[model samples]
Target: MLLVLSEQEKTSFTFLTSLPEQVYPDLVKTALSQLLSTKQITKVVNSAAAKLKVEVASLTNSSLYVLSQCLLNSAKRNLTPEDLTSSLKACGVEVTIVTPLVISYTENRDILIDIITRSTVQAPEYRSMEWRLECQVGSRSLHNTVIPNVLTKWKISDPRFNNLKTKETYLNCDVNTLQHITESLRAAQLELDTLHARKMCRNLARIG
Candidate 1:
């Protein structure tokens, strides 16, 4: 996923590029070596910052971006902000704003809610309780069903979904839509449970 960097963050990128070409590779190597030895992102980052003669907090955004790229390269794939943060925590870094760098996948979650509520998912004949979502991303559109099992679906999408990297499409929009539908269904199920519990209580009262 691409980072939609803030204006300040964009300006901060110059700090990274200003370093000598050789220094960049050496810095990456040092960070990786430190990570392997100490298994702590903080130490790896601290060591790199010391080499650059900069405080860790002063170059937080630039340093974390480099570290994030390292993690992604090692993993050989893309990671969500949550996954990236978890990986960093496992290595002992505590950078908080890394998540805000990437735009939220759930930003348009309500639009999907609006679409579903306007559809026939809740109609009398549609007993499946699932809605098929036809989403358009640029010239390419995909058809996916909103189901309760999103974790499984996301697993499937992990390897197959390339639209995320494309400038013309929003892959997370479809994913978020499915996740929201799952949540709404769960809420509806809980309400049904409560009503059933009340009905059972009324039946027992009449028997007594």
Candidate 2:
């Protein structure tokens, strides 16, 4: 899979989002990282953001572009943001940005050098019934980007090896778009303590 949100894209997206310039990069980077955790790879993989590694054509000119060629090339590789985020978590990546649940994949692999969303898996929350908050998120985006060069890594054909629904319960959005959470894991807004994005950018200029 190819990811578009570059280290620089994070910078630009931050500008667009109109978030504090100082803190925007962190937020954008965090948003991009989510894709790595909480996304699915179609027929080959299940919707469990357990682990994700993406490839990109290049990160040039303070801009970023990504091209994700589908591995399975499933006839219907339509994935939701929730599906992607959950899968990323199952592997190890954490997603916490405003989840953009919809992404498109190609049947054939190609080099995509365009801006792409950085997927993320949200920190787990408690169901409204159980009601807990141990899973509160810290970073703006779920991805860390501490490890670069996400491509060149091989993935399992199917993580499940076999698709089995141990607990059978129809999802709220199996057909239409819907993001559901078990009554046990509902949440209020996450409280993030951080610096401002705009200020940080200015600081970089001062140092440079």
Find the candidate with the highest lDDT and give its number.
1
**Candidate 1 clashing pairs, residues 3+ apart or interchain:** 41-91
Instruction: Quote the lDDT for 104 in model 2.
Output: 29
- Position 71, candidate 2: lDDT: 14
**What local lDDT does model 2 show for residue 201?**
62
Q: Over 4 Å off in model 2, which ranges?
A: 1-76, 97-208
Q: What are the per-residue Cα lDDT tens digits for candidate 1 across 53-168?
A: 78887545564555434443323333454654454445433233223322221232343234334442331121122224554433335346333322221212221233232122
- In model 2, what lDDT does residue 192 have? 19
- Local error of candidate 1 at residue 154 (angstroms): 20
RMSD of 1: 21.8
lDDT of 2 at 1: 26
TM-scores for candidates 1 onward, in order: 0.29, 0.18
Global lDDT of each model? 0.44, 0.28
